[model samples]
Target: MRQEPEGYAWSRFGQPEYTNWLDESMSWKETCYIGDWSFLWQHRFTGPDALKLISDFTVNNFEVFDLYQSKHAVHTNKDGKVIHEGVLTRFGDEDFMVHGRGGFWLAYNLEKGNYDASVTNEDWFMYQVSGPNALALLQKLSGSQDLADARYMRAVTITVAGHEIFALRQGMAGEIGFELQGPSSIGAEIYQAVLEAGRDFGIRKMGGRIAMINHLEASFPTIATDYIPAIFDEDMSGYREYFLSSMPPFAKPAYINGSYDGKDISEYYRSPIELGWAKVVTTKRNDYLGAEALAAEKQSPKRVLRTLEWNGDDVLEVQRSLFEPGEHFAYMEMPRDQRGYMWADRVEVDGELVGVATSRGYSYYFRKMLSLATINVDHADVGTEVEVLWGAPGQRQKAIRAVVCPAPYKEDRSRGQLG
Candidate 1:
């Protein structure tokens, strides 16, 4: 089994048990899980131009994020395609930790060396406590519920079982969740304390298998899984070396082979707008890496990202009817074929297709088979009819019924008022 960084115990899935805890925590009254976010690159920027530099590189306006507050940010290329997306936390004047998908972010930051920011990829510990009784469980572990009032993306330092850690109210699953970030040295102790405290609340460790499955319902896009990494300009020599040296074994083999427009695999690059990141694109800022290109694309975005629901009966019947029982219906990365650089086209519409269907999974909670795709805006209106082609040429092209719906097909119960 692949062992995670210190403080995380290995699971039968070869991933850490804490990942499984995240999935199990949702159903339980209260549950806690520890994650080794060490693999996520960490950078500290503390200069006059730190905020401005980041603002110029990303789509979100950072001026609005106050100290102790956090918000999601997206880094795009010259084409405004998504390179990296994560939570940007404000620690002080110009100090912050941007957490989430980092492989491309680290490379992009290195390329834009004009800034005074200092980036570091080191070992950091992160844990998540979630569920209906999460606040109470945190209180038991930390000796205080001061964290309960902390709004989403807000961070606060607290002592738990003699260990000091920074707790942030943020989670991928739509639940009352808190992320505990601290030194790797204290990870094991902190993990044990949270698990012990959660015993009475029915918390258990989680694995990545279920976590990947649940991400579809959470509406959180996985970097290489749901979409292709945005690679701007063929001069990726620096990026190639960085990936070879710094990328972790778990995150390596980045490319999803044969998952693009043609079988060649070089035709894939997704912009922020195509990935359903319009809210984060702030035009108020004068300039950024891909601002101009994005602005033009925005006027008439070639493609769009949307959620699609498969006919329930069709999905089940297929599952039961597979003769050879091939790969269990994993998500497809099929691209729309259009004339020139037109965003991926909707299978049903001749309009430009910008995005491809990235994630598709069975929502056990919702009891429906749903998919997330990035297509053209003209085809994005909710209730719009579309067709999903299955199989390859000859034996390929079975049209499946699809409907355009909200990005998050699953209802988020995490934002509700807690007792």
Candidate 2:
């Protein structure tokens, strides 16, 4: 008899959920939240060669990276596959900060290549205050009722809880939000102040489970969740070993989920266009690594990112199996993917494999099961019929019917909110 294999899992970045998962998820839609983001890495670069070196690797048009402004930076391999991506901010002519794994990619390149720049990882703490009431909370904490004036992706330094914080008018939930970044030493002070001040506005604390709901609702593709880190392959083995050596045991990338019938892991790598970041790639006369290849690939992308709406009845049927059946499918975790494995599920059209779905989750705001999928362009049209191969392979897998829908399943309120 085969005991169900110990299910895969991941640790939430924070202490734990303050509010329950369901309420915390609904907070983004009804009120607001303060999400602990210190788990993400921030890499800072300074010196004359910093901008040039970054430009050499980034797919974005850095011609417009002015002080106090930030751009979505994406780095791809020589083959045009995304190596890493995150927000790149310019604080001065030659001083910059990039947050997320993209920082690791930059760090790796800095060590190998000859560049006259100094790179250091900063342990700065980051907190996201988001939703309709987010600005209200910021105003209350900073006493800067005028904080609402900060434009999108622009950074403004202000004192909050008596600590200087660089507040960027950005958000993950696609709502009116601010990313408060500052010294790690005062992270606790700032976080506590905001929580107390935001009580009136109904601010909830976000946990790992509910924090990423908007990624699916707003249609943001994520690394590790959507595709494996590009650093794990043979071509990147040297860098991969070096990267893993410095990390803790729990941080390794060792899980593969879903029923992707691919023999090679590289079969899952995605290009910028396929990931819905085509606009970020700009070569226009300036050649970067993979510039020519990406320019060519964009002309005819194999697939495009989209949202798949699962059939409610079929989904319910899968859940119903849990009670009576000898072999029941895994239960759908709320707000985000559970069972690890990047939550990728194979997509098919008339039983012919077409693409793979990633970032599967349920959005209570929309009251639907949603997943970000990189589908074959041939069948990428809205309203197209397809099926999601749910559950682990050879483990009571079920085919749930689905429909092609818009990538951002909801309106992105983060675009141009004034306050």
Which residue runs does candidate 1 get wrong by more than 4 Å?
1-36, 100-114, 253-260, 263-266, 323-355, 392-397, 415-419
Pairs that collide, model 2? none
Q: Stretches of candidate 2 above 4 Å error? A: 1-12, 417-419
Clashes of 2: 0
* TM-score of each candidate structure, all chains considered together: 0.81, 0.94
Task: Mark the 10 consecutive residues where model 2 has the least summed lDDT.
Answer: 1-10
lDDT of 2 by residue, 232-337 (tens): 5688887787777865544555366676666777776778888999999895845677788899878878889999999999998888888874988877766665
Candidate that scores best on TM-score:
2
lDDT (0-100) at residue 219 of candidate 2?
A: 83
Using lDDT, give the best candidate's number. 2
lDDT of 2 at 99: 88
Estimate, for each residue in 1-419, the C-alpha lDDT of model 1 and write its tens digit: 11122222223123633443335535533354444454465665556667866776778876578998887878877767666788778788867677765424643664566776665544667776665667778877787667866777788888987877888887666667788887788878888888788878767665544554456666776675666556535665656466546555544434332223444334556777777677778877648878888777777777777788767665554444454455433223211111111122225543334336655655555656677887667778899877655433333234556778887665565564344
